[model samples]
Target: MKLTFWGAARTTTGSFHLLETRGKRIALDCGLFQGRRSEFFERNRDFPCPPADVHATLLSHAHIDHCGNLPNFVAQGFEGNVFGTNATMDLARTLLLDSAYIQEKDTQFVNKIRARKDEPPVNPLYTVEDVEPCLDLFVEIGYYRTFCFAEGFCGRFIEAGHILGSAQVQLDVEQASGAQHRLVFSGDIGRAGRDILRDPEIPGEAQTLIMECTYGNRPTEPIEGLREELRDLVTRVADRGGKIIIPAFSVGRTQDLVYQLSLLFREGALPQIPIYVDSPLSANVTEIFRNHPECFDRETRDLLRKEHNPFGFETLTYIRDVEESKALNELKEPAVIISASGMCEAGRILHHLRNSIHDPKNCVLIVGFQAEHTLGRRIVEKRPKVRIFGEEHPLRAEVKVLNGFSAHADRDELRDYAFRVQTRSGGMLERIFLVHGEKEAGEDLASYLREALGVEVHFPERGDTFEL
Candidate 1:
């Protein structure tokens, strides 16, 4: 079997991998590459190999970075089954459509500037029309149910605990010579004791491992005191009569914050200020989360058993209408506004940052990892000035990052996961390929894993390939 690193190789975004064996080519994850505008367009628009040549696509989750480019891939002629968990398919329906809308709107805005410069108009990567065909190709598979999609290829999905339906993919490939191989792909491994979802499951046995190393360098703060920290931050900002603007992903992170806030409010530990979820996609995704109780953790499931909605509270409102989203800017009282595009590269969060970032009394709460070159990273770095909508704005808002709420596993957790996987393999594991991390993170992880596991660990780069 031949494996190629196509994307998310030494980077935290765009998770695409190609596996070729038994005269069939399969895609691991066809994700959109998120980065600078020029690189983003060129990378996502072009495929290393013909999309039509790929027999099937195995999706990890509904996060845009992991499954965002499926529409474009299908539009480019990939007519094959897109396999994912039932909840993943449902979440992807909402996420992919939102991605298409963003693509069209962003292209239109970019083309307006090009028209003034006499440059040719650019087209969107893909549209809502393109997304429909892709959704039709999705085949829902339940967790741990093994199935064969092509000749000589069979796979199963294990609970990844990252999001509502995130999973780690394990594939068994039989070659023409009748030799079999087990390959496990750790699809964004999640923390063990998280709030909403179950802990990541370890694959039973594997010879080759393809894993993520998103937080390979450092450990995150424990989940224990996170609620108290959030309450303190919110209380401080509200007491100062300033809005606490939170840039969170629409899916996992937003729901996590809401759940925690619900607990705090129930205990009367937080201020009685109004809270708002300002993205339509977040509201829709939250509803999807409610429908997937099988994916919830024991605590969340018990909460639901009591007929309590953890995502909703009396003081909180979900805004969907454009006018209602706009009205947030006119609020005179202190409030908590949680918006989407967690990286602050797009969405209503940009507008919130542009407005509130100039006020020192306000606070910008960052609740997830921010990729390089993103506005969220700039805010985290406390840049003096940041550009939003082609205009520079002073970044005076107090920036507070709460990494405890991250869904991705930290360094210690990742080490423990690798150890468990290796142990489960019964010393038969051959090699480990690390992806979904930056250069330093991958290097740090490679060094640590080599010393601990005493195995061949390679941090592959884009276009790097190896034969097994």
Candidate 2:
């Protein structure tokens, strides 16, 4: 069998790998490359391989960087089965539609600018029409259950704990003589015992492994520290009679916020104030989470045991409609409103920030990873002013970050997981290919693995291949 690192090899976005075995081909992930518009658009709009020739697709999760290009694959004439867990399918149902909407809207916006510049208008990479066919191709694989695709290959989806339905993929290949080979691909791993998600399921053993190292150079703040910090913010905002706005990712971070708020409210740590979830996608995702009780950790289950609702409380309101969401701006009293698009890039959160930022009393509590050049990072840096909708506004609102709420595993956590795997497998994972991170992070994780586990780690470049 041969494996090719097509995307996310030298960069952090677009996650994809091509696997060839026994006269057939399988794709591990089909994701969009996210970066500068022109570069990102061109890279994602084209496939390195013939899309129609692929036999199957094994999805890790529904994050755009991981599963974003499935529709494009369909658009390019791939009709193979795409596999993920039930929760992945649920999240993809929301994420793919949202992505399609963005793609169409982006094309329209870009075309208008092109018309002004006297340049030819370009078409969207894919649209709702493309998303529909891709949705039809999804076949949900239950966690831990093996499913056969083409000859010489069988795979199972393991819980990755990054978000609802995130998974690590393992493939088993057998020949006619009954000799077997195993490969494990660690999808973006999350911290254990976070919110409603189950712990990342550990792979017992495998001959080869591919892993992610997103936070390889940093150690996350303790979860208890985050809880205390949030409590303090709540007490401060309530005492001052001011509102707090949180811009977080809709999938994992939003759910964590609700669950933690419920926990704090239960412990008498929160004051009586309104909490509004302003994203319709988050509200829908929350419903999907409620449907998967089996994914809950003990702490989340314990909270549910008494309160009967781990993600809901008396003060919480989920706003879905445009009018209802607009009405939130009329709120004059102290409250907390959580919105999506984490980066404060393009969302209703911008409106909230614009309205509340000039007032020193209002707080913008940031609780997710802010990429470089994003508005969220600028807020964290306390830039004097930031541009919003082509206008610059003063940055008077207090910006506080709670790093403990991060979904990805930090360096220490990744090392611990690596050692745990090392001990269990008796050094079976001799070669580890690190992907889905910046070059420095990949290099740092490689050194750590070599120093601690005495294993050879390779940081493959884009289009790099290995024979095993």
Candidate 3:
């Protein structure tokens, strides 16, 4: 089999890896490349492997970075079955469409500025029409179900406690010599025992193991402690009669915020302020979480059995229509509005921030990890001023970055999962390639995996391939 690292070699956004055997191809994940506008636009707009030759696509989860570029793949000539869990499919239905629309709108916004200066207009990577055709390829399977692709390759998806339906994929390939080779791709390893999702399942054993190390260099403090900090911040903002604007990702971060808000409401920690979820995609994604109660941990399951919906509390409203979404800015009352595009790159979040950033009384709650050079990162750094829609506005609102809400496994958690894989498979795990992290973080994680787990580590460059 031939395996290639096409994306997420030294950074986390785009996640693509290709495996080929028996004259057939299997791509692990087709995710968007998010960074600078021009770079991201060019990278995600095309497929590394000609979509025509690919046999099948296995999606790890439904987050944009992991599943965003699938529509673009379909827009190209790819027409194979897309594999994922039921929740991943559900998320894909909304997430991919939303991503396509964002791409269209973002490109239009950029081209509008260029047009003002007599520059040529840019085209969208894909459109809603492209997304409709892409959704036709989705094939949703359940956990532990063995899915066969091509003639001699079979793979299974186990829960990777990262999000509602994230999975760690294990592949079993049979060569012509009648010997089986095992491989595993840890897709954004999640926390060991997190809320609302079962802990990650062990994927038997493997000779070659590929894992993610997003937070591999940093130790994660317990998320349980963050409630107090969040409560304090919300209370202060409410008392000041200002709105709380939270820019979170539509899939994971949005759900986590709603769960935490439910807890705050139950404990009477937060004031009775109206809450609005402005992204339609998030509203749909939340419903997907509701449908997959089987994925919940025991505590969350028990809570659900008791008729306690942990994601929904009193005083919360989901706004979807354009008119309704715009109306949120008109209300001067103390409220919490959660919008998508976590890093303030696009989506309704920009409108929310543009409306509220100038008010000193408001609080901008940043709950997700922001990359470098993003507007969200600037806010996290508490920049005195920020530009939006070609205008500079004073960053008067207070910014509180809550790191506890991360989905990716931290340093210790990554090591724990790595060792657990070693314990399961009786064979010696050869090499562990760390992906989906910055250069320094990937290097640090590679060092830790070698030292702590006694596994040889390799950080491959883009287009690097290992013949197994």
Candidate 4:
């Protein structure tokens, strides 16, 4: 079998991997590459190999970075099945449509500037019309139910605990020579004791392991006592009569914050301050979350059993209308506004940042990882000035990073996960390849895994290939 690292090789975004065996080529994850504008367009538009040549794609989750480019992939002539969990399929329908809308709008805005410069207009990667055909190709499978997706490969999805329907992929491949191999892909491993989803499940055994190292070198703060911290922070900002702007992902992080806030409010630990979720996609995704109780953790399920809505509260309002979103700018009272495009690359969060970032009394709360070159990263770095909508704005808002809320596993948790996998493999594991991380993070993880597991570890770069 031959495996190639197409995307997310040494970076955190765009997770595409190609596996060739038994005269069939399969894609692991077809994700959009997120980065600088020029690189982003070129990388996402051009595939390393012809999309039509791929027989199938196994999706890990509904996050844009993991499954965002499926519409483009299908539009490029991939006619094979797209496999994912039921909730993943449902979430992808909403996310991909939203992504297409963003693409069209962003291209229109970019073309306006290029037209003034006499440059030729460029098209969006994919349009809303491109999404329907892709959506029709999805085949949903329940967790742990193994099924053959191609001639020689049978795969299963294990609970990944990352998002509502996230999963770890396990493939059992039979070569033409009648020899069998087991390959496990750790698809964005999540923390063990999170409140919303179940802990990541470990596959029994596998010879080849492809894992993520997003937080390989960084240790995240514990989730314990984060409620009190949030309460204190909110109280401080409210006392100052300043708004607290939070840039969160629409799917997982936003729901997490809402649930925590609900708990705080129920306990009467937080002051009564109005909170607004200012993204239409988030409102839809939250409804999807409500429908999928099988994906919820024990605590969340128990809460639901009591007829309590952990995602809703009296003071919290979900805004869907553009006019309502615009009216938020007119509010003078202190409030909490949670908006999406978590990296602040796009969406209503940009407008919120542009309007409130200049006020020192306000706070910008970062609840997720920010990739390099993104506005969220600049805010985390506390850059003096940031450009929003082609205009520079002073970044004076107090920036706070709450790592405790991160869904990805930390350094110690990753090590423990690797150790468990090795132990389950019963010393038959051959090699480990680290992907979905930056250079330093992958290096740190490689060194630690080698010393700890006494096994071969490789950090593959983009387009690197290996035969097994």
Model 2: per-residue Cα lDDT over 14-127, one tens digit each: 899998766678998898776555576678877768899899999998887789888888888889999998988888978888777766765776688678889898887778
Clash number by candidate, in order: 0, 0, 0, 0
The TM-scores, one per candidate, come to 0.98, 0.90, 0.95, 0.98
Q: Candidate 1 lDDT, tens digit per residue, 1-468?
A: 899999999998999999997779999999988877778888997777899999999999989999999988998899999999999999999999998887787677768877888989988778899999998899999999999998889999999999999999999999767999999999999998899899899887889999999999989999889999999999999999999999998999999999999999999998999999998897788889888998988998998999999999889999988799989999879999999888987778877887899999999999999999888888999999998865799999899999999999999998899899999999989899999999888999999999999999999989998998
Off by over 4 Å in 2: 103-124, 174-179, 238-242, 302-307, 330-332, 354-359, 385-394
Where is the poorest 10-residue window by lDDT in model 2?
32-41
Model 3 residue 72 CA deviation in Å: 1.2
Tens-digit lDDT track for model 4 on 90-194? 999999999888888778877887788898999888899999999989999998999997777999999999999999999999987889999999889999889
Clashing pairs in 1: none
- Model 3 lDDT per residue over 403-463, tens place: 7888878888887788888888765687788898888788998887788777678988888
Model 4 C-alpha RMSD vs. true structure (Å) is 1.3
Measured with C-alpha atoms, the lDDT of residue 333 in candidate 3 is 95
Q: Which structure is stronger by TM-score: 1 or 2?
A: 1
Clashing pairs in 2: none
Model 3: number of backbone collisions: 0
Candidates 2 and 4 compared by TM-score, better number:
4
What's the lDDT for residue 392 in model 1? 90
